[model samples]
Target: MYRYTDFDAAFVAERNAQFRAQVERRIDGSLTEDEFKPLRLMNGLYLQLHAYMLRVAIPYGTLSSAQMRQLAYIAERWDKGYGHFTTRQNIQFNWPQLRDVPDMLDALAEVQMHAIQTSGNTIRNVTADHFAGAAADEIADPRPVAELIRQWSTDHPEFQFLPRKFKIAVTGSPNDRAVTKAHDIGLRMVRNDAGEPGFEVIVGGGLGRTPMIGKVVRDFLPEADLLPYLEAVVSVWNLLGRRDNKYKSRIKITVHEHGIDDIRARVEERFALLRPAFIGVDQQLFAQIKPDFAPPAFKDRDTAPFDQAYSNDPVFRSWADTNLSAHRAPGHAIAQISLKAHGATPGDATADQMRVMADLAERYGYDELRISHEQNVVLPHVHKADLPAIHAALKAAGLATANIGKISDIIACPGMDYCALATARSIPIAQEIATRFDQLKLEHEVGDLKIKISGCINACGHHHVGHIGILGLDRAGVENYQITLGGDHTETAAIGQRTGPGFSADEIVPAIERIVDTYLSERDSADEAFIDTFRRVGMTPFKTALYGESDKKQKAA
Candidate 1:
């Protein structure tokens, strides 16, 4: 994990002190809720339906053991006993009190963490592949670039109040684990024809009322020109993106309306003006940041013990199958500690669980841990030979779940349960869906499906990008769940099509079962996954099964 520099420490400490005073002022009635809204949002606090929610940034989803312990303390001492990890690689406390937010911010600052840019979007948490430094397929680590953007964008005087929030994501691997296409700006690390690493910059990609895959503005931008080029992109969008209509304010919508060619032309003009002035931030600075994220020491060993454990222990065997991966280094493996614990909340990893993860990272693994966009933790460089011992520790700590890239592994938001803006509850719906899928034991057979649930149209749960996506909406105070099929999150990403009429909370799970069952029966082969099958067949049968085939407006023969 990257430790905070003295500059980083001082900045957060000052921000904490200021937010604490602001909270006091709000409590004493010196500042009305309206007056405090922007201030609170700047500190990553929001006034939800029941109480205030505080979003704390976990930069690039990395946490230290001590930091994890502090998060546990905050959860236990302040709000509820659990915290929800989000898709943005941030954590949200749904029940934070207005009075305690300052204290919470201070606690985070101690861990060199803060709530800045977590909410209200100003270049919100520059996320990357959770397995960036550890992934076997990575060309170069993306965190140094992500962190560099984080520093450049934080409280940027030019961009504090844009028409809408902005998001940026970077990925080191050819595999898009970070869902870069679902971000306002997605930067994939790539090599040019000349064989020098650079970025393939994509713009205006996001998931919301209007879901879109970003357009490639720069096919190959040299590694040295990242910041200046990024600044140009944001500057163009900030000035020209719509402000007249909130629905049309997002950069995605603007890009769609204005066309990518026009946007690219404007960005080029801006880049021309600013590129020279930003010469200070060159490849040298990136080289400096690399050492800060260097891998920890590991002893060379063999994988014999792990092979033996898998041969003997069934539970360890299952975990090894679902959670372990081949590492780039010999004797090492990547352990994906699942956040999906049977029927528990999908992304809610208990404070204790976080501590266990941190300890494992500090001990058997590399003093390093990563939180995936799927809301799971990764021990990126654990010795494969030590898999048995690591599995034992994980099981004892209650961090054993044998579902990764399976239906039980759901990406969900704190819906009506915690969010004021949400019309329906997302956590319980996710729980029910996960439990149902677990009972079926058909997730792996179904294979590589993403099930995302969002509480509302904001699309926080990435419902737009799931192979099987669900959106929860409140109709006449009754919770109604909407289903979409065939959405994907790969190189060939596609938005799901709506199945049909909405289902009541009680009817939602069964409806999903019908769809999955239909796919199972109708699929050409077991190898033809849910997405492939859905792509082939469309949602007509799923709709007919849910709403009788006769309900179809198109006259049936």
Candidate 2:
């Protein structure tokens, strides 16, 4: 993790003090709600449906034990006893009082964390692969570049306010764990013919009312040119993106209106001008940041305890099978702690749960923690020998759900529960689906599936890329849920196709069950996942299953 320097500390302190003054003025009637909106947004504060919400950024999803403990403390002292981890790998405190926000900010500053750029039209938190340095398949760790981008963009005068919010995601692995394709700027590290690692830069990808898989603007860009190239891309879009209509303000829309070729040409032109200004300063900073992300000194330990537990305890076996990923270090595993436990809200962790995870990370995980974009906490470098003890601790904390990438491990946004822009409730729907699948005991049977739910067309839950995507909307004051199938968020990214008419809230869960049952029956073998089956068989079978034979016949005719 990147430690904050004196300059970093001073910068955050000054920003916090400014926000404190701004908060005081708002309370004193010096600034009205409308007047304080932008200021508060710049600080990552939002006036939600019920109360104020504060979003704190977790850069590249990396956290030290002390930072995690501070977050738990903030959750307990300022807001509700739980904080919601978001799809962007940030945390949201939903019940913070406006008056106490400054205090909360101060508390976060003490831990070298801040809420800045977590929201608003500027670049949000620069996300990377959660398993950046630990993933066995990584080309190189992407965190140093991510950190460099963060430092460059934090308060850049040119990009403080863009036409709309922009997001950038980076992944060093070939497997695409970061969902790089769905970001404004997606950087996938790849090796050139010379065998040097570089980035495959993808641009114009976004999901909302309009979902798009980013186009590869550069097949291979040298690692040294990353910062300048990124600046060129954003700079071109910042000037060309629409400001007349908020609906079409994103870079995705801009790229759609102008051909990718034109956009590429313009970015190249801009790069030629900006490259000199950035000669080698960014690379120098990147070199400095690289040491902070070096791999932990892993111990040569026996895996006998892990093997014993897997062989003896079915519970531990199930959890280890589902929640663990291969680690680069020998006898090490990546442990994913599920927040979506049965009926619990997805991406939420209680203060006690947070503390438990913090303690486990300190004890067994080399004092490192990561927040996955899938709404789970990751102990990226846990030795296999520590698995039994860690599993026991997690089970006691209600965090040991063996449902990673399973049907019950859903990704859902706050929706109407907290968001003012939501049309219907997403949290309850997610809870119902997870609970229904758990009760049926078919989650493991259903296999690896991603069910993403967004309360509206905003796609905050990334519904557009889910294998079974659910979009909740209000139709004539009643909640209607729409379903999309075959969407993928991996390297071969594709936007999901809608299955046809929306279902009532009562019918949504059953509809999902029908889709799963249909997949099970139609798949060539048990090994064929739902997505592969959907792709092979197309939407006819699932559509017939969802809309009945009569509707299927009607469409056929």
Candidate 3:
């Protein structure tokens, strides 16, 4: 993990101090709620359904053991005992009082973290692959690039206030684990024809009211030209991007309105001017940041013990099958600590659990942690020999939920409960579905399903790409959810098809249950997952079940 330099430390403390004073001003009426709203939001504070919610950025989703402990501390001291990890690779503290957020920022600054750019229309948190350094198929660790971009984008004079919130994601691996297709700017680390590493830049891809897959602006952006090229892309968008209509304000729309060729041409024109001016930091700055992310040295222990353990423990075998990922290092695996424990909230990790994970990270694994886009915590580079001990320690902390990629592992946004723009609730809906599935123990039977929920058409919860997608809507002040089926998010990604009429908030769960039951009865085999069956048969059964109707023949008659 990258430690903050003194300059970084001082900057955060200064920002926190300013925020603390602002909070005092707001409480004393020197700042009205309207006056304070933007200021508060700029610092990652939100006025939620009940109380204020504070979102803290975990840049590139990498955290040190110490930082994890601090997050746990914040969860314990300020708000609810639990914190929700979000799809953007950020964490949200759901119940913080407005007055306490400044203090929370202060605490974060101590660990070289802050909430700046966590919110606001400015470029939001720069996210990357969770398994950056540890992934077997990485070209260069994307974090250094992410960090460089973070520093560049943070309060950049030019892009401080864009037409809309800008998001950027980097992935070192060729496997596209970072959901690059769904971001405003997607930088996939790639090699040129000559084998020199660079970025394959994709622009315009986003999931919103208008979901469009991004187009490649640059086929191969060289290593040294990365920052300048990115600046060029943003500059072109800032100048030519939409501003009149908020719906069409995104860069994706800009790219759509003006074709990729024009955008690329404009970007190239912009790049020529910007490239020469960035003489301050080049490969040297990267060289400085590289050492901070040096891979941890592990004991060259025998893997024979791990094989023996797996043979003896069937439970561990199942967990290993579902939760473990390959690591770059020999005899090591990345461990996913699933928050989707049956009936519990999908991404809520308690303060105690965070502490336990920190301890586990320091002890059994490398003193490193990652927050997955699927709302799970990852302990990257854990020795296989430590799996038993790690499992036991996790079990003790109530953090050993072996439900990674299962039905219970849902991705949801802070819908009506927290987001001001939400028309319906997402968390509670996710909870209901998870609980129902757990009670039936039918997650395994259902198999490899992604049930995503977004409060509205913004699609932050990624309802557009879910295997069984649910979008919450407002129907005359009543919360309703629309279901979409047969969506995918991989190389085979597609928007899910809507079954029929939307269901009331209360009715959505049982409706989902009916859909699941229909799948169970109609499926070819359990081996054929919900998605495979949906692809094979189409949405007729699920639609019939949801709409409370007979076949189309009866309707036509």
| Candidate whose lDDT is highest | 2
Q: How many residue pairs clash in each candidate?
A: 1, 0, 1
* TM-score ranking from best candidate downward: 2, 1, 3
lDDT sort, best first? 2, 3, 1
Q: What is candidate 3's lDDT per residue for 25-113, written digit by digit as tens?
A: 99999999999989987888888777888889999999989999999999999987889999889999989888888888888888888
Clashing pairs in 3: 205-214
TM-score of each: 0.96, 0.99, 0.94
Q: Candidate 1, residues 1-557: lDDT per residue as tens digits? A: 56678888998888889988988999999999999999989989988888888988888877777777788889988988888888888888888888888888888887788999787747788888888888888888899888888888998998888888999888988988888887889999999888899999999888888889889999999988899999999999998888999888889987998999999999999999999897675566666777888877768877789889889899888888888876777778889988888788877877777777778877787677777888888888888777787788888877888888888889898888877788888889889988888888877787777899999999999998898899999899899999998887665777888876789999989988888888888899988878888778877777777777675765464
Better of 1 and 2 by lDDT: 2
In terms of TM-score, the best-performing candidate is: 2
After superposition, candidate 2 runs with Cα above 4 Å error: none
Cα TM-score of candidate 2: 0.99
Q: Comparing candidate 2 with candidate 3, which one achieves the higher TM-score?
A: 2
Q: After superposition, how far is residue 378 of candidate 2 from its true place, in Å?
A: 0.4
Where in model 3 is the C-alpha error above 4 Å?
Answer: 517-529, 540-551, 554-557
Off by over 4 Å in 1: 551-557
